[model samples]
Target: MMSKIISENKVAQVAKLIDKAKNIVIVCHIAPDGDAIGSSLGMYHFLNALDKMTTVVIPDAMPDNLLFLKGTKEILNYSKYPEFAGELIEKADLIFCLDFNALKRLGEKMEVAIASSKARKVMVDHHLDPEGFCDVTISHPEISSTSELVFRLICRMGMFDLFETDSATAIYTGMMTDTGNFTYNSNKSDMYFIIEELIKKGIDKDEIYTKVFNTNTVDKIRLNGYAVSEKLEVFPKHKAAMITLTREELNRYHYRKGDSEGLVNVPLGIENIVFSAFFREEKDFIKVSLRSRGSFPANKVASEHFNGGGHLNAAGGEFYGTMEEIKERFVKILPLYNQYL
Candidate 1:
């Protein structure tokens, strides 16, 4: 049996909303990671089983690596179909905001639509300091992933009998990827028990791992090699390593969306380094991914400097301006966190 993490009252409130809702839409954060997509899709499947009309709207395109999930094709991308996505939000009777804290995390347009909608909102997430935008907020920073929270929430609602193969696969993917395949933020004994339950649902964990991590293209492999060999910079004094990828270099390698998935974690294998940062140049901003070992608070740096926040060990931020400018900002901020190193 799993421990009860959500309050019974909150569960009842969400249950009532789910029961009353006719048109339900699930939305995840911008730059949807594995957990974001996983929780959204997991909820989508669960809702489908309940015979509710369901739609999954993502702020942007998901990583190519994640398209294998059962319902990826049906997911509405706000970036690609703004009008349709907006219409779905407008028509939704209930909205499940998964894997994100603030309304801003939905990006600009989606945030506006969700905020203005008369639909009741429920937030299921594991991020820090969630904004009070939802009618019922299930925020647990200690949970490994939002997918795990979704699983727990379903069970609490007495809907565990509705768990099926596809929902199990999606939830397992979120738990696996968000923790870097059980590398970090996965120390709880209950996590293994949850995996046991998922396995009982006939989810082949090995196959899911293969599909997510092993199905990388040749270009992705080359991109990883170039990142480690050419762009990697180790600040031994700070016990930190940084990898930067420019748009031109990404184009050179024919970079796809998920090509740089685990690049930030590669340097942490070194004996002394405790921190790693990856900066990928996007069209308008530099997307920053920060990872750390031990008790280092990567999310603090992300929130304080880079306009982002997440878990302590793993976090991300975004920076505007040239790559060099962001690099300079990183250098300038290193001394503040030197004590943690």
Candidate 2:
């Protein structure tokens, strides 16, 4: 048996909330990744098993690859249907905020909707420095992924019997994707025990991995190739590397939403490179993703410079600047972190 990671009192609070609520809604951050989608759908499945009226809403679109999960069709994207999504949150008796720490993570427009929500909120996440917004905040920064925390919450509430195969597949996909297929931030033995329990639910772990990682389009393949071969910058003294892609460059290759998903982690595979950053140009800002090895503290770099924070090794933030400007800033800041390398 895995050691108890959740307190019994919080579990009781969640159980009581679920027991009384009539309309339930689940929400995740904008640009929802595998963990966001996985944890939301996993909770949706559980609530369905209990005959609870539930809906899953995301601030924006999810990756096409993740469409393979069990309930993608049932999900409502707030960007696409703002009125309907807002209505659900407004009507919900209890809202489960999954995979994100702050209400602002719901994006500017949806943040307004959730902030006004009268529904009692419970946040289950694995991010650090959770804001004091939710009624029951289950944030475990040490856990590999938010899906793991969702799983722990279910078991701690004694609802593991309702945990079915589809939920297992979704949660496992999040765990695998967030950890880069178990390459980083996955040292906990209990994570394996959780995986063992998921396998016992009859989900095919190998198939899930293939579907999430192996199924890439031709455009995505070419985009990644171009990004690495043409844009990758390496600094020998700092043991650092960075890759930047402007909007024009992305459009040239028919860039899709998730095309550059793993680009930041690519540099770490090279010999002696401990830090990697990927900056992809968006409409008004550049999306920043940073990764590092050992004790380099990539999250510090993310929070300090990019207005974001995450795990020590993997973190990201946003910057409102040109690609050239961001690249120069990163290069100028490299010396400050040289000692860590």
Candidate 3:
């Protein structure tokens, strides 16, 4: 836990930053998850209520379950709207870097725009030690989710009522999924308090859970089986397990949308497995997802070596290489686990 004085000071500083800006652009990491989309849309709606000009740009399209959020339909596809994105980002008075602590993770294209923009950058996230590029950074690795912190900020600013039921639902979805429905190591009392508030706003918890987790297409099930049978590889002694799937495999399996979500968690269920990872080979990059079941800190592993950071138990990164190279690199690094396991 961070000291009260430190956390309060950080919060106050970020509030001051947001209060001063009129035009803001919000961004999350590439290949975003529930938390990324949820937090971004949550903040966007709150800012919209403030009558401030805000645009939410996602590096990639949102996953299926998360598409029910309020602003999901309006989310600007930055890759497709490059010119409009450039104009908005350039003219904005502030840039809210949410859900992700580092700007590089926003992707190569967006990073350049962020660096060139004159907007004062303000970061609101709950990730590991950040890069400290923002004028004001509100990052606490101990927090359960970015939505948790976003809601807290709104409450502190006395704008809690500005949150629409849709905003609350979206925020709740992110907070729920990122904390694994409060199953991860980061959950705290404040998380439940936020959920209670969202419930009070008439956000349907069961339906949101059903939409995000329970509903899966038939193709997704087949993809899961294919990933488990053909791609999953467990190291001797069960210290690590990995699943590698290529675009061709994805096509052959008829991988539907959001098929890869939470696939890394499959290996963590195996007894004696300290760590689990997924190597997803996309057309241009190798997306790596890392998870840990016991005392292992997967975020540290990803941040230190894989150029990424996330919750202690769950994290991800991307590497530039062929699928074989990615596997060899991950395999070679397995020996380092002796220190933790």
Taken over the whole model, the C-alpha lDDT of each candidate is 0.94, 0.93, 0.82
Best model per lDDT: 1
Candidate 1 per-residue lDDT, tens place, 181-268, comes to 9988878999999999999999999999999999889999999999999999999888898999999999999987888989999999
Q: Which wins on TM-score, candidate 2 or candidate 3?
A: 2
Best by TM-score: 2
Scored by lDDT, model 2 comes in at 0.93
Candidate 3: Cα lDDT at 333: 83
Ranked candidates (TM-score, high to low): 2, 1, 3
Greater lDDT among 1 and 2 belongs to 1
- lDDT string for model 2 (1-341, tens) is 89888888999999999999999999999999999999998898989999999999999999999999999999999999999988999999999999888888889999999999999999999888999899999988889899998989999988899999998999998899889899888899999999999999988999999999999999999999999999999998999999999999999989999999998899999999999999999998999999999999999999899988888998899998888899999999999997798
Model 3 misplacement above 4 A: 1-6, 236-238, 303-309
- Comparing 1 with 2 on TM-score, the higher-scoring candidate is 2
**Tens digits of lDDT, candidate 3, 1-341:** 21232266766776777788988999898778888888888899889988888999877667877877777878887888888988899999999898887778788898898888999988888887788888878887777778777877777666788988987887998898887877775445666766788999989999999889988888888888889988899995548899999989989878765798878888878888879999888777888789997678888878776776677788887788899988898888888776788
